[model samples]
Target: MLSHLEFSGFYFIKNLHFGELGFVQSAQGFIFLSGLLVGLIFMKRHERAGAAQVRRRLWGRALELYGWHIGILLAILALSRLMPDSWFVWNRWLGRLYDGGDVYVAAAAALLYQPSYMDILPQYMAYLLVSPLLIQLIATGRAAWVMAGSAACWLAVQLGAHMPLVALLDGLWMGGATLQPRAAFNPLAWQVIFVSGLVAGALAARGELQPRRLLDPQRPMLFHLAVGGLVFFLAWRMAITTGLIAPEVLERFQAYENRVEFGLVFLLNFVALGYAVAWLLVAGQRSASYGLRVGATLLNRLLSHPFLVLIGGYSLQVFAWHVVAVYLLRLVDWHVGPLAEPLNSLLAVAAIASLALPARWLASRAPTRLADAPQPSRS
Candidate 1:
């Protein structure tokens, strides 16, 4: 969540360039953790209510996200018109929505084709849509089958043997206007990561998963290797972003987008960097230094504190509010010239941070305690 907030705040700072310098890996962590939590929650419920109930509830969540996507888009459109410089239509993604008369139809289909700044939720909706099948596979002790299928789908995408569902939507309906036919993050390839996270989370929750590799204090080699991979990626990224090396020079080893396949380099970067983060988070949890221990103590307290737990507990509201916060901050960044630069930066931070305020309020309103306690149950 901090990474997300920072990303939104610095969307103003970065100002339309997504280079190697940006926080690229945070999206994976966000999605992976999301699926992890979903797995933890859904698997427990599945065990109780069975796969059918799990599917229904999962679909309900997807429907909620679908509504959220449309709502956020409409909200942006409504607010954009009120601005004196309502230029998103001409200057940005609003043009995609403005392209046709049957935009009503296109809007209905936003789930398949993604809009800019609003892709992750829809992709998550897609993931959750299939989660029941995933759960069934896991329940049958056939999770390897799902993993194999996910890998095959990813490989099919890599080999150009797959189709973008959005383009198919366009060709079949919507009069063949091919506007933005694929999500920026391809769900085909990324579902593997989601399923992987889900498996890890579910197993851990069930007390069947262990971080035996780097979590083991006896073996420091795996930790060093993970850290080394991260350092290498950072140095390589620096070389490219700083123009010390040409990007194309490493094209065989590393590539970006390339018409939207997550190339080998991208996957390697995610795994390597994710491992580094998990290494620190899990392995370093029990370090010997007094200051480190104190810091961890405070960090755990802050994380469990009502403030963060509130926002974390209600992922949907916080996510929707983030979309609203981001574009509003973008408008302010563009228009508020008197308070440019640093103030813009500060305001962006405040705006993104403000998402927590309402969430905390909502969470606080929940009946965490009885209206009036019964005098300690009187033994």
Candidate 2:
């Protein structure tokens, strides 16, 4: 949400771009973690119930996401129509919707015309739609095959195979409009992260993978390497952001850092950072070192705060609301131009605080049976 606010021109803190902090951004984590949780929860569901239940639940989730996508787009369209086009500063993606007429609307409804920040939900929908098949493979002890296929798909995308596929699909349906290939994030390239998480979660669910083993005191080398890689990436990011590095030098590395394709740098950084954090948390609870234990306790407490937990519990609702908040903030920027300090920072914090509204509302109205249902362990 903070990242979205920053992207929407809310400079909550000067020179602090949350989205640009390192090689990997929150979106990668979000996608990977979502896949992880889905894999863990639904695999358990499949075991207890059956494949039918998994299909039903996952398809229902896809439908809910589809509804939210269309509803959000409609809300944005309504707001755009109500505001004067000359006065509003529209993002290029949203602007295409305003100008492209009904064809764009139809395309968006079909999930082929995702617009900027609005794209991720559609990607999630696609993943959820195919999740049953993925889950079946994982459950049947073919997870290695599934992972290999996912990696192959990601590699194919990196080699530019997805481009022609997108072009072909567009040609079949878009006439000459050229919108199908314009998604902000390519699912093909990004699925590797999701599948990696899925396989790990499935293994963890089945007692084949013990996450706590990541903190084994004997693995000091792994811990040290993770810390070293994290520090290097942090320094590299700081250099670029703080102008300590030459632009041309950074430009040469841009290909490996491509956000659209889920580049190599991001994959490596996420792995290192993820392992370090996991080890820290696991060690915080079970480590022999007192100082490390105390530090981990503090970190865990901060992460597990009730307010954060509430937002996490209704993550989908919060995510949807965040997108709405971002678009609405853009509308505000359209009228006021760029906001000055204090005001900008104030609005930014308030926008983040407002994310809890949907979560709270949903919590209040949550069905009793659903609320009481057994949840998968975060451990």
Candidate 3:
């Protein structure tokens, strides 16, 4: 968004797809940072008391997430109804299920059901409900064991649980079968990333700083980030250039829609991109250049604002709102042409910035409570 407007007049920039950067990296960064922050908070909490205390505190947080989930679900439904009629259509019945609505009734009946919007909230609830077990595995003192066991559990969750469970509960129309078309965003398949985040958080809490320091800027982080990113791009490009990555798989990248369960390649690239962006952001913050300082200051302020941050914190909400806002605007009058794209991009940036304000405010009230939380044992 920032890129679109700031560089709009530049002939070379006008043709570039800045939205691709927005699509792939941002969510992964959010989730990764969420995990990192969780580690930072939980480990501190555990240090002040014990495992039992930490679990109890986390349980409360899990419940809060569930409450928030329900509220968000309701809000999505309300927004769907309030949207212009042109905004509501029966294109792909399965797509509606992705957005969180009735499965059987909507699919079989081919109806435009109210949007219940089930994505991050349900997965998060599942994660929270099972986090005690996750924490126990992480605290077991061996990184290999934590990684291996977490993988096994997450696999079990997908193969043994969510896919089958969703199938049984929602029927074939909206369950495992949907994986054929939208494999990446399925919560069942995507829990792998979430669990990976949990394990990463757990390891960080244990004072194993290798992963965090992997791109820590004080130590030539940019060089490492560049090397890593270059490697990924080369691999992807080579495969593409050689017709190695299958057409179906390559097509998925072109689909490029944002969803909770992104494909493995997309997932990897997204996280790597996130690391690159974050490292650059951090480096920019410390640079002596005036432009860097200005960029960093604005970034910090946007990230620091409480309401804006709260809205930012609830990424699912921001995404839903952004989509609705864009589509609704289009439906009202379609011929905004090339300018529409940049304008919508700018609007989204503004929305995200506004959302961060609340997040900053809420974070300010947390130091005292956070101070008392116990820390994870660091060996």
What value does the lDDT take at residue 229 in candidate 3? 68
**TM-score, model 3 to reference:** 0.59
Per-residue lDDT of candidate 1, residues 1-379 (tens digit): 3333332233355443333442345567778887888778888888888999999999998998888888887787677667767555224644455444565436546555455567788778989999888877787777678778888987887876766664666666556755445466778887777888887776666666787554654454666686677677677767766778755676654544342466565666677767655654565556554554465566667657775677778777887788767666556555644464676566656775687876876767666555544556666
| CA lDDT of each prediction against the hidden true structure | 0.67, 0.80, 0.52
Q: Over all chains combined, what TM-score does candidate 1 have?
A: 0.82
Give the lowest summed-lDDT range of ten residues in model 2: 6-15
- Write out the backbone clash pairs for model 2: none
- lDDT for model 3, on a 0 to 1 scale? 0.52
Please give the range of 10 consecutive residues that has the lowest summed lDDT in model 1: 1-10
Q: Candidate 3, 329: how far from true, in Å?
A: 4.3
Q: Which regions in candidate 1 have their CA more than 4 angstroms from the true location?
A: 1-23, 104-110, 164-167, 176-182, 205-207, 212-214, 250-260, 287-307, 338-340, 367-379
Model 2 agreement with the true structure over 140-163: per-residue lDDT tens digits: 999989999998988887778877
Q: Which number leads on lDDT?
A: 2
TM-score of each: 0.82, 0.90, 0.59
Query: Using TM-score as the measure, which candidate wins?
Result: 2
| Clash count per candidate | 0, 0, 35
